[model samples]
Target chain A: MKNIYVAFCCEYKKVSHSKMLWITIVLFTFIPMMMGLMIYVVRHPEISAKMGLIAAKASLFGNADWPAFFGILHQSVATIGLIGYGFVAAWIFGREHSERTMKDLIALPISRSYIVTAKFLVAIVWCLFLSVILIAVGLMMGKWVGISGWSHEVFVHGMTKYFVTSFMTLLLITPVAFFAGYGRGIIVPIGFVIITLILSQFIAIAGFGAFFPWAIPGLNTVPEGTEGMQLFPISYVILVLTCLAGYLGTLAWWRFADHHS
Target chain B: MEEIITTEKLSKQYKDVLAVSDLSLHVRKGEIYGFLGLNGAGKTTTIRMLLGMINATSGSAHINGMKVHAGNTNLWKDIGYLVEVPYAYSELTVRENLEIVRRLRFLDDKHVVDAIIDRLNLTQYAHRKAKNLSLGNAQRLGLAKAMIHNPQILILDEPSNGLDPAGIYEIRELLTSLSKDQGVTVFISSHILGEVSRFATRIGIIHEGKLIKEINSEHLEQLCKKRLRVKTKNNILAREVLLQNNLICEEIHDNMFELESESAIANPDEIATLLVNKGVPPTMLNVVEEDLESYFLRTIGIKGGAK
Candidate 1:
C-alpha cells in the first residue's frame, strides 16, 4: 500500500509537470464548446446565413432543446471520450518507453506492478477530469444558448446517463494501456485506438455492439427503446472481462516480459 | 571477502542469437569489478539480467544470495544501477528528477538529493530541465540518481561516457573514493580497458558473449608482453650481429631492432656490449611494454583494431 502511494506520488508529479495534461484539458474544453456552438446555430436560424458549413452541420441536431443537447453530449462523450481517454492512457504508459525511461522504473526497489497501478490511477483521474470538463462546459454552453425544456428530472437523468456512458468508455482504456506497454510507445496504441474506433462503429451498425467491448460504450448512448439498440446482460460481462484482461495483461507484461527497451 | 554479486551459468538467447552464454563470475564486497567488452559483446545484457530488468534464459543471478527476478523487489534495496545510456524525464529539472528517484527509493530525507547533486557537481544545473542539459551533465544526472540512495552495490554500464577529461578524472576519483571509503561494491562496464585499468580492482573481459579472461589489476601488468627495442646507428650490421649471436631480432621500424627473446630483454646491457664490440653501437635501447589497448585487442584476437 505504501509502495503504491509513493509510486502514485511520483506518477502524479510526472503528470503535473507535463504539457500533455493541459493539452488534454484544452481539447476536452474545446470539444464541448464546439458542440455548444452547433446548438447555438440551431437555436437561432438567422445566424445560419452567416455561419455557412457550421450552420449546415448544426441542422443534423434537429431540435435545439435540452434533451437534444444532452443526447448529443452523451454521444460525444462516448465517441470523443474514447479517443481522448485512450490518448491519455497511451501517453501515460507509452511516454516511459518513448523517452527511454522504462529501464529506471523496472529495476527499482518498488514493484513494477505498483508503478503500473500508479500510472493507471493517474490516467483514470486525468480522463475523469476531462469528462467533468466536457459535461461542465457543455452545461454552461446549453445555459448560454438558452435552449428550452430545462427540468430537474431531465438534468438528473441526463447527468446519470452521461456519466454512465463516460464510465463505460473509461473502462475501455485498459486495453489501450496494455497496447502502450506492448508496443513500447504511443504511436502503436493510438493506432490501435483508431482501429478499434472504426471497428466499433461498423460492428454497432451490424447489430453486434453488445458483444464487442469497444462498441459497448458507444451503444450505451442510444435511447433505451430504440429497436435493435438495447444491450444484453452479457454485454456488461464481456466489457468487464475485457477490462480485466487488459488490466491483467498490462500487469503481467510489466512483471514478466523481457524489457529490452 | 564476501561475494556480494554472483552469476552462475547465466545465458540469454534471442531467437537464434546468443547474447550472454553460460557466464559465471563473482564480485566480492567493496571491490570495483570492471567489465570490459566490445560493442554487442553482451555487457549491457548481463547488467540488465543482474538488475532483473531482463531474465536469463538458462541460468540465474543472485545478489547477496537472493535470486534476482522482477518480483524480487526487496533485492533492489541494496542495489543501484544505470544501464547503457541514462535517460530521465526530459521535462523535469535535475532536482525534480533526483527527488523522484529519492521518493521511489523510499528515502524520507530530502537532503540526500541536494547532497548527491553537490557531490556530482550539479548544483548549478539543479534547476535546469533535463532536456536542456548537455550530454555530460545528463550523464552526471544519471550517476546522481544511482548514488542518491547510496546503495551497497552499483551496477553501472559505461558510467564515464560523454564526460570531458576533467569530468572523467573526477568521476574516477569519486568512484575510487566510494569503493575505498564507503565499501561500495561497483560493477562497471566499459570498452576502454586503459581507463578501467586505472582504478578497477579486477577486470573481466567478455567477447562473443563469453567471459574469456578475469584478472586482478595487480596481475594485469605481468600479463602484458615486454620487448627490448634497440635503435642502432648501423641497423643492418646490428641485426646481423644479433642474429649471429643466436638472439632473434627483427627490424621493426626506422632501423630499430626489436628483440623479444627473454635473454635480450633481461640483459639489454649485454646486447649493448655485444653491439659495441661489433662496432654497431646502439642509440636507443628501451624495454617497451604493451599498452592495455593493444593487449586487450590481442586477447580478443583483434590486433591493431582489425579482426
Candidate 2:
C-alpha cells in the first residue's frame, strides 16, 4: 500500500505540472462562455438581429431562462465530458509510450499494476477537476448573462443532474484507458473516443440509448422523461460491466503482456 | 565467486525472427561483465529479458537466485538498469526525473536526488527540462537515475553512447570503483568493444544472437594477435632474410616487414640479429599487439583473417 501511495504521488506530480492540464481547463471554460453568449443574444432580439447568422444559431436553444441554460450545460457535459475525460486517460497512460519512458517503469520495486492504478487515479482526479471547473464556470457565466427563473430548488435540481451526468461520463472513460494500453499510444485511444462519440449520437437516435454505454449519460440528461430517452436499470449494469472489463483488461495487459518497447 | 546473474539457454522468438537464441552466461559478484555485440545482435533483447520487460520463449534468467519474471519485483529493488537510448519524462526537469525514480524506488532519503545530481555533474542542469538537454547530458541523467539508489547490480545497455571521450572515461572510472570497492555487479552491454575492454572484468561476445566467445579482460592482451613489425633501411633484404629462415613475412604498404609467426614474434631479437647479419640493419623493431577493435572483429570473423 505504501508502494502504491508512492507511485500515485509520482503520477500526480507528473500530471499537475503538465501543460495539457491547463490547456484542458482553459478549453472547457470556453464551452460555458459560448453557451452564455448564446443566452445573452437570445435575451435581446435587437442584438440577435445585429449578430445575424450566429444569433440564428444561438436562438436554436429555444429560451434564455435558467432551465434552458442548465439543460444546455447538462447535455454539453454528457458529450464534451466524454472526449475530455478520454483524452485525460489517454495522456496519463499513453504518455509513457509516446515519451519512450515505458521501459523505465518496468523492473521497478513497485508492481506494474500499481503504476497502472496510479495513472488511472491521476486521470480520474484530472477529469473530476475538469468537470467541476466546467460547472463552476458555466454557473458564473449564466449569472453574468442574468438568465431568469433562478431558485434554490431549481439550482439544486440542475446541479444534481450535472453531477450524475458527470459521474456517468467518468465511468465510461475506463474503456478508453484500456485502449490507451492496448494501442500503446494516444492516437489509437483518441480515435476510439471519436468513433464512440459519433456512434453514441447514432445509437441514441435509433432509440437504443440505454443499450449503449456511451449513450446512457446523454439519455439520462434529457430532462427526466423524454420519449425514447428513457434509461433502464440495465443501462447502468452495462456501463458498470464495461468499466470492470476495461479496468481488469488494462491491469492484465500491464502485468502479463510483453513490453518490447 | 558467486554468480549474481545467470541465464540458461534463454531464447526469444518474435514471430519469425529470433531476437535471442540459446544464450547462456553468468555475471559474478563484483565483476563488470561487458555484454559485447554489434547492432541487432540481441544484446538489448537479452537485457530486456533479464529485466522481465519481455518474456523469453524458452529457458530462464535468474538474478540473485530469484527467477526473473514480472512478479519478481523484489529482485529489482537491488537492480538498476538503463536500456537502449535512455529516455526520461521530457517535460520534467532533470532533478524531477531523478526524483520520480527515487520515489518509485522507495528511497526515503530526499538528499539522494541532489547527491546524484552533484555526483553526475548535473548540478548546473538540475532545473533544466530533459528535452532541452544535449545527448551527453541526457546520457548522464540516465546514468544518474540508474545509480541514484546505489543498487547492488546495474544493467546498462550501450551506456557510453553519445558521450564525449572524457565523459566516457569518467563513467568507466565510476563503474570500476563501484565494482571494485562496493561489490556492485554491473552487466553493461555495448557494441564498442574498445570502451568495454577498458573496465570490464570479463566480456562475453555475442554475434547474431549467439554467445560466440567469453574471455577474461586480463587474458585479452595475450589472446589478441601480435606481430613482429620490422622496419629496416633495406626492406627487401629484411624480408628475404626472414623468409629464408622460415619466418612467414608480409610487406605492408609502409615499407615494413610483418612477421606473424609465433616463433618470430616470441624471438624478435633473433630476427633482428639475422637481419643485421645480412647487413639490412633494422631501423625499427617492435611487436605491435592488435587493438581490441581489431581483435573483436577478427574473433567475429568479419576481418577475413584465418581463425
Candidate 3:
C-alpha cells in the first residue's frame, strides 16, 4: 500500500507537469462550447440562415430543448470520449517508452505492478476530470442557449446517463494502455484507438454493438428502448472482461516481457 | 571478499540472435568490475538481465544471495543502475526529475536531491529542463540519479559516454571515492578499455556474447606485450645486423625494426652497440609496451586498430 501511494504521487507529478493534461482539458472544454453554439443556432433559425454551413449542421439537433441538449452531450461523450479517454491512457503508459524512461521503472525498489497501478489510477482521475469538464461546460452552454424543460429530475437523469456513458468509454481505455506498452510508443496505441473508433461505428450500424466492447459505450447513448440498439447483460460482462484482460496483460508485459528498449 | 553480484551461465536469445551466451562473472564487495566489450557484444543485454529488466534464456543472475527476477523487487532496494543513454521525462526539470526518483525510492530526506545536484556539479543546471540540458549535463543527471540514493551496488553501461574529458575524470573520481569510502560495488560496462583500466579493479572482456577473458588491473600492465622498437638511418642493414646477432627482429614499419626477444628488450644497449658497430647506428631505440586498447583488441582476436 505504501508503495502504491509513493508510485501514485510520482505518477501524479509526472502527469501534472505534462502539457498533455492541459491540452486534453482545453480540448474537452472546446468541444462542448462548440456544441452550445450549435444549440444557439438551432434556437434561432433566422440567424442560423445567415450562418450558412453552421446552420445546416445545427439542424441535426432537431429541437432546442433540454432533452436534445443532453442527448447530444451523451452521444459526444460516447464518441469523443472514446478517443479522448483512450488518448489519455495512451499518453500515460506510452510516454515512458517513447521517452525511453521505461528502463528506470523496471528495477525500482517499488514493484512494477504498483507503478502500473499508479499509472492507471492517474489515467482514471484524468479521464474522469475531463468527463466532468465536458458535462459542466455542456450544461452551461445549454443554459446560455436558453433551452427549455429544466428541472431537478431531468438534470439528474441526464447527468446520470452522461456519466454512465463516460464510465463505459473509460473502461475501454485499458486495451489502449496495453498496446502502448507492447508497441513501446504512443503511435501504436493512438492508431489502435482510431481503428477501434471507426470499427465501433460500423459494428454498431451492423447491429452487433451489444457484443462489441468498443461499440457498447456508444450504443448506451441511444434511447433505452431504441430498436436494435438495446444493450444485453452480456455487453457489460464483455466490457469488464476486456478491461480486465488489458489490465492483466499490461502487468504481465511489464513483469515478464524482455524490455530491451 | 564476498561476492556482491554474480551471474552463472546467463544467456539471452532473441529469436535467432543470441545476445548473451553462457556468461558467468562475479563482482566482489567494493570491487569495480569493468565489463569491457565492443558495440553489439552483449554488454547492455547482460546488464539488462542482471537488473532483471529481461529474463535469461538458459541461466540466472543473483545479487546479494537473491535470485534476480521482476517479482523480486526487494533485490533492487540496494541496487542503482543506468542503462544505455539515460533518459528522463524531458519536460521535467533536473530538480523535478530527481524529486520524482526520490519519491519513488521512498526516501524521506529531501536534501539528497540538492546534495547530489551539488555533488555532480549540476547545481547551475538544477532548474533546467532535461530536454534543454547538454549531452554532458544530461549524462551528469543520469549519474546523479544513480548515485542519489547511495545504493550498495551500481550497474552502469557506457557511463563515460557523452562526457567531456574533465567530466569523465570527475565521474571517475566520484565513482572511485564511492567504492573506496562507502564500500559500494560497481559493475560498469564500457567499450573504452583504456578508460576502464584506469579505475576498474578487475576487467572482463566479452566478445560475441562470450566472456573471453578476465584480468586484474594490477596484472594488466604485465600481461600487455612489450617489444623493443629500433629506428635506424641505414636502409636495410639494421634489420640484418640485429637478426645476425641472434636477436629476433622484423621491420614492422618504414625504417622501424621491432624485436620481441627478451634479450633484445631487456638489454637494448647490446642491440645499440651491434647496430653502431655494423655502421647502422640506431636513431631511435625504445621499448614500447602495448596499450590497453591494443591488448584488448589482440585478446579479442581482432588484429586491428582500437575501437
- Ranking the candidates on DockQ from highest down gives 3, 1, 2
TM-score of each prediction: 0.96, 0.93, 0.97
List, residue by residue over B10-125, the lDDT tens digit for candidate 3. Answer: 99998999989999998999999999998999999999999998889999899999999999988988898999998988999999999999988888999999999999999999
- Highest DockQ, which number? 3
- Arranged by lDDT with the best first, the candidates are 1, 3, 2
Per the 3 Å backbone cut-off, how many clashing residue pairs does candidate 3 have?
0
Chain B alone vs. reference chain B, TM-score for every model: 0.95, 0.91, 0.95
Model 3, A146-249: lDDT tens digits are 89988998899999999999999999988999999999999999999999999988999999999999999999889978989999999999999999999999
Please tell me which model should have the higher lDDT, number 2 or number 3: 3
lDDT of 3 at B208: 94
Which is better, 2 or 3, measured by TM-score? 3
Candidate 1 residue-wise lDDT, A35-57, digit = tens:
89898898888998789988899
Each candidate's lDDT (Cα)? Answer: 0.93, 0.91, 0.93
Give the lDDT of residue A162 in candidate 2.
95
